[model samples]
Target: MTESDLIAALEDAGVHVVFLPYPKPGSYWHAHQLIVIDARLSSRWQRCTLAHEAVHAWYGHEGPCAPETEAWVDERAAGLLVTEQAYARAEWLHGPDVHAIADELDVTPWVIEAFQRTLRRVA
Candidate 1:
């Protein structure tokens, strides 16, 4: 879904989203059902951060997340943001360059990496 769509879905699910100058790109507070995204980030990063934080909220995560939890979140966010068909098309057009593929996919390289990791796990 698009960023606006995701935001609307989160709001519909009782999660409030706000933009502020945060140190991190985004954070999800499960206790408050809130998501705070750093307004200073670029639009693409904001989209990425929103997807990541949304997954945390979807899973009802609380407190600091462990490494495994973070990885799982990234995978889930990547799945939500980037489809396998689109990723394949981008990779075919741009070869193996993460940045180029991400640019084509309209996502961050981190999302591309996470998607790649998910692909590996499935393979």
Candidate 2:
């Protein structure tokens, strides 16, 4: 989905999105019903961040970061941005290249790496 679509979906679910010049790419402040995404990130990166934060919100994830929580969020974020079908298509067209898959999907290479891992877990 496009950024606008994602924003609309979040708003529809009663979550608020805020763009700010934060040091991190994005954060989910569950207490305030707010999502803060860094304004300086590229559009694709912003989408990925949004997806990650959205997962946190959806799962009602809170408290200090833990290994399992971080891993779960990362996996969900990658799946959201790069679905199984999309990943397969990208791989077929890009020949197993992370950068190329990311380019095709409009997400960062880091996201693509996570996506690759997600694909592996499901295979």
Candidate 3:
């Protein structure tokens, strides 16, 4: 989905989406204040970052926590972005070509792989 699409979704849920167009030093998303997106990134990468950040907002991750909590948040965001049905369908259709699915989803290939692995362990 487009950034506007994601923004609209979040706004509908009562979250504000703000765009900060500058050099993408690193993707950062804060839950407490608002969703600040790095506009320098491609729309695809923006979508990935948006989903990841939104996961943080959804889970109410306010501050730094235990290492396990951080890991869970990151992996959970990846899984939520890729999603269970999407993951299963991608697995069935792509047959180990995760980068292809990541290309389609606008997420990093490694994120997809990790998300798939996380789901495997979870299930």
The numbered model that scores best in lDDT is: 1
Candidate 3 Cα misplacement greater than 4 A, ranges:
22-32, 92-94
Query: How many clashes in candidate 3?
Result: 0
Q: What TM-score, computed on C-alpha atoms, does each candidate reach? A: 0.97, 0.89, 0.69
How much is the lDDT of residue 86 in candidate 1? 98
Expressed as tens digits, the lDDT of each residue in 40-90 for candidate 3 is: 877667777777666667766665567777566658668656777877777
Tell me, by TM-score, which candidate is best.
Answer: 1
lDDT minimum window of 10 residues, candidate 1 = 23-32
Superposed model 2: Cα runs more than 4 Å off: none
Candidate scoring better on TM-score of 1 and 3:
1
Q: Give one digit per residue, the lDDT tens place, for model 1 in 6-123.
A: 9999999999999999999999889899999999998999999999999999899998999999999999999999999999999999999999999999899999999999999999
Candidate 2: tens digits of C-alpha lDDT, residues 40-97:
9988889988988888888877755798788778888887777778888989999988
Write out the backbone clash pairs for model 2: none
| CA lDDT scores, all candidates in order | 0.95, 0.84, 0.68
lDDT for predicted candidate 2 compared with the true structure: 0.84
